[model samples]
Target chain A: MSSSSAAPGRGDGAEKPPMRDALVAAAFRLFLERGYEQTTVDDVVALAGVGRRSFFRCFPSEDDAVFPDHERCLADMTAFLAAGADDEPVRRVCAAARPVLRMHAENPAFSVRRYRLTESVPGLRAYESSVVRRYERAPAGYLRARFAGPRDGALRADVIAAAVVAAHHNALRSWLRSDGKGDAEAAVDHALGQVRAAFGAGPVAAAGKGPEDVVVVVSRRGAPLWRVVQELETALGRG
Target chain B: MSSSSAAPGRGDGAEKPPMRDALVAAAFRLFLERGYEQTTVDDVVALAGVGRRSFFRCFPSEDDAVFPDHERCLADMTAFLAAGADDEPVRRVCAAARPVLRMHAENPAFSVRRYRLTESVPGLRAYESSVVRRYERAPAGYLRARFAGPRDGALRADVIAAAVVAAHHNALRSWLRSDGKGDAEAAVDHALGQVRAAFGAGPVAAAGKGPEDVVVVVSRRGAPLWRVVQELETALGRG
Candidate 1:
């Protein structure tokens, strides 16, 4: 909708546009045409019909322009995780990833273009990695606080948090690599399902030995009896 | 050993000292004394008694000096993983992390100091995240290639790779935060053990069902029998 309003560089006769939108549109256009490195802050402002002060007000630097919405998305994710229930921490974290997925899905062309650009640029790749880590930390920090215990709870929190982020990225990247075609929601859900299957035991199984105990192991139906017994023992922490 | 020969800036008599080492020493000294931002490349060259050419030859930038050995360690890890047998991808990846732990362990004082410095500097933290992501990619790429099959193998590979890195960082950070005191090897091993338990099933268990199957589930001793049955069914993929 914003793109149709006025051409990026061409100052179409209209009321003064939103500076942030104009700057972002101009920056992305310049980046795609001349490459990220070749495009400068002045180029962005010149195209947007703005000055250096306006550009700096919108973005800290040229690199920040490439990822204009990360701060907003990160804040939303942190707030989502903060509002999660004490129970089902893993599920809550998984749910928190939805907004991110939606943000990309809402703008498929931009997401795909950004993904390709990031893949080609080392600095952008590094900056993207930091952004990804911040997202990971939000969930991991939440889980760490919720699962604060002397046992392996802290480790579990970190592992599950990393796993969730990995799965989300896996699904999202696959969709992006496909140029944003196909059912991204289903792809994300399927990926999340695998995470749940792998780590969805929740606090119940993690508590490991209430007053009573039950041990179940899954292996090949035709597995040798001894192997089954050994697996059971291993699962029970005996072997 | 290098530290004992001469004070970093004093330049004690020694024929043709290693320019790389000298630059690093000078840079760290200045960084400590004046803070990372306050120190300049000229200051480092002046203290090291080296030219700008020599400093640039040794380090691409000031940040690169802070992580002098990452390239060598990364190469070592890649070679270790490359030599791995096809059947034990998880174990091989786990083994690949050992050298990194050893790198930190070999220089406790330097590692602790670098940890403190990185903790205080946002630039360094972002740089470190990028470094950590590189390490994560090596193992994840290995697993993705090895687990190149259906049934969430890619997802599993990515998740496990992330989990291993997270566990390693958790253990390493705890040790560094303690000023590198205590048994870091044992701590890393324990952390890796949790990763193995949580995600060690590898591609074999990940294959789902074979000709036959056995399902095992463990619950608290006092858990209801029905809950045990339900968990067993879920583990068996029936529920």
Candidate 2:
């Protein structure tokens, strides 16, 4: 079928909005029906009733089509962090993650489809990791800038950014694995809350004390009572 | 030049040790001289005095050649964690990271060369992320097993595992960026120490007290005195 005959509303002079949507819809349909690897650019264009040129203009590659607006979401997140207030770095990073979560949550079916596709394909999984690394670097870089002074500031920034991203992924994946039926917002909020508590981003650290005054400690469960008392005494003495 | 003429000692009956070493050396030399993309498996084989079959046997692909022993290293790490005692999960995870760090540190020249190549090539970077993810999952899985009871056990496992891996990467990257010239052992020690401190693996939580009895609050520096006082009062009251 020719482009004009197959898709009546689409023409050479038609605006980008419907054409883009049609292309994405068609591409996803083909990917789901025939598998991501089996589907070709020609197949997508034929199904969408658009020319090859229009397809390329919309998506640089087949993989690009699967994640059409990641770049935009990333840019939005960067902007959100760039405009963040100086004091609440953890809050800013967590907030920066919202757009990404919403991007997945808003399109439950598409996100779930893409998630399954990525899970099955090693190449797509690598591509997805690269995309996730970009999202992680954004927050890490922002936190690195904010945490410029201490010796371990860069390290702290990186690990916390990684934790935030990991939490976001954990929540998003759980929701996706459930076929997107549950309350995603609550899941994400609970996940991010765990991150905040684990990282200790409460009123104390957020108030901006130097590192010398704060000595956080972590131990495994079920220590001897005497050991706990001794450690507590040491910690209290240090404080 | 023919394989026999270029590498006099290599032949069909030759043992695997020298052939593997020769192939790696030849591949690295070519990758450095001509760039990674510009070098091919044929070039590597011809230079190493090996046939195509041998190259494929030793390494699945050119990218795989760049990271020859990651599989072995990952296996070693997994074994290390698997044999760990039940009480010290953090220590076990941190110890598991040492093999990977040692793998890079023991062969500084090759590690640096590969690091530079990965930095220049987007594909290699993605490949590297996949490799790193495997390492991250090892500890995350181990921690998840240990933290099985708590509601947020899985989340804690993943984030802490991410933090451990991030600290390892941060230290490793810093060492690599410095051209492998540094007290890498000390750098890693300090980095992991920060992870241990920030995550709060202390005596109190390890002693099995409920969340209400354990008032582990983190406050910021430069908080209003009254706010700090009020928080302290509230925490004390709760405890």
Candidate 3:
């Protein structure tokens, strides 16, 4: 998407430690200077002062270098969830969602840059979807394990995971739209809190009295709306 | 990715007034027979016995032809939601979600084939994400409009939309994993019902008193957990 290809970073920050970081930084430098598809691994290694083995070691493809922090963030999130005590599951997952938002907040310029770069390329947009799906799986795995007993546990896990991710992104979008100048943590916390309020163990459960006696209605699956309403009315003793 | 590149269909079902459908059928035959990359617009037109204009009229890109029915399904869903009269919005969105699942169910083999085809191609998988986003936006738009009053209304709408979509797909995946042989409607209804339970205007409201008085514990937005719990216990007169 950038206008022209240029020789980028001839021996800039070549002495950096952690060969992986050097390769990714150099890749992003060249990737921005000389569009995504136009740059090659050879070009990246030359600027990075690393070997092709090192380049491949750091990135799957040129586009993948744009998101260099997801693996670390995902690992930290997994470890955080794994170390958690038996807190409420919905609250726990909402807690687990913070590290991801914080990861983006840590480097607004980099994320903003990557955001614009990704929006410009169809291939990168596709690649972004794959990256997102990877993050979605972590919370989903934790919830699936926690909610394993119910028949709908897996479905619940998937829905809650998706809700968390969607809410997280919704908040992040506002922060990024402000060019990363807004309070990301507050926005994300507020958004995830909404998810918790909806899916969390409710005030009824928190009060330690069961919710069933309040009202209960049962209807066969695939019943018509009228029939289901009739069943509910009958349950309320009003039919 | 199909194995080899070869010429495909010549004048099969050319008389169909639904020129769009024929063009897509022809494109798929060639895309599967040859490779997706190997097939070109010119080749598709030659095989379908249609002019180049017709092919371009029907699809945006070569990959766009795969999801032939989404626009129609989206229109039907939008109309269904628009026509809904004063129903509970969460349940309305869930009810609105069915036609999309049914659209896929209407043609199991075609969906099964598209599923396999999409999985085999990364670009198609990316395209699938865009298509799914389109569907997600429908429920999201409806919810945003309906819940427009509160400050968090938009965020609530978004996460709920994502939850419904995730549940819908979870059930759809079961049906698709069965090679589209499973009962998609029953599965989807069950999944969406879970969403309804989580987000519905509860039986408390149905019992005709607002849900506000069940256990009201007011706390500041950014209050610490202990402070909030202290406030809650004070509200319950146990402080």
For each candidate, the DockQ is 0.38, 0.26, 0.17
Candidate with the larger TM-score of 2 and 3: 2
Please rank every candidate by TM-score, starting with the best: 1, 2, 3
Q: Which residue runs of candidate 2 sit more than 4 Å off their true CA positions?
A: A1-16, A203-239, B1-16, B200-239
Q: Which parts of model 1 are misplaced by more than 4 Å? A: A1-17, A202-239, B1-17, B201-239
Candidate 3 residue lDDT tens string, B1-239 = 13111111222223334567667777778778887878898998888789888877887777767777677678988998888758778888898888788777866777777788888877677778867777888989999998899787888788889899999989998898899986799999889876765565322232343434334343333333323333433333322
Q: Which scores higher on TM-score, 1 or 2?
A: 1
Clashing pairs in 3: none
- Over the stretch B1-239, how does candidate 2's per-residue lDDT look in tens digits? 22421222221234437777778778777877888879999999999899999999888888777787787788888888888857577767887888788877776766787889789887789888888888888999999998899787888788889889999999999999999999888889778865665453322342345544544434334333223323533443311
Per-residue C-alpha lDDT of model 2 across residues A1-239, encoded as one tens digit per residue: 22322112221233447777778778777776788789889999998889999988887777777787787788989999999857578768987898888877766777787889789877678778878889899999999999899777899899989989999888888999999889998898888876665453433432344634643323223343223323432443321
Per-residue alpha-carbon lDDT of candidate 3 for residues A1-239, written as tens digits (9 for 90 to 100):
12121112212223334666666677777767888888888998888787888777777767666676677678888988887758777778888888788777766776676777777877677777766766778888999999899788899899999999889988987788788997999999888866765565422232343434333333322323323333433333322
What C-alpha lDDT values do all the predictions have? 0.75, 0.73, 0.70
Greater-lDDT candidate between 1 and 2: 1
Best by TM-score: 1
What interface RMSD does each of the candidate structures achieve? 7.5, 9.2, 12.1
lDDT of 1 by residue, A63-159 (tens): 8777777776788889888888664777788888888888787677878888898999888899999989998899899988878875767777888
TM-score of each: 0.81, 0.78, 0.70
iRMS, candidate 2, in Å: value is: 9.2
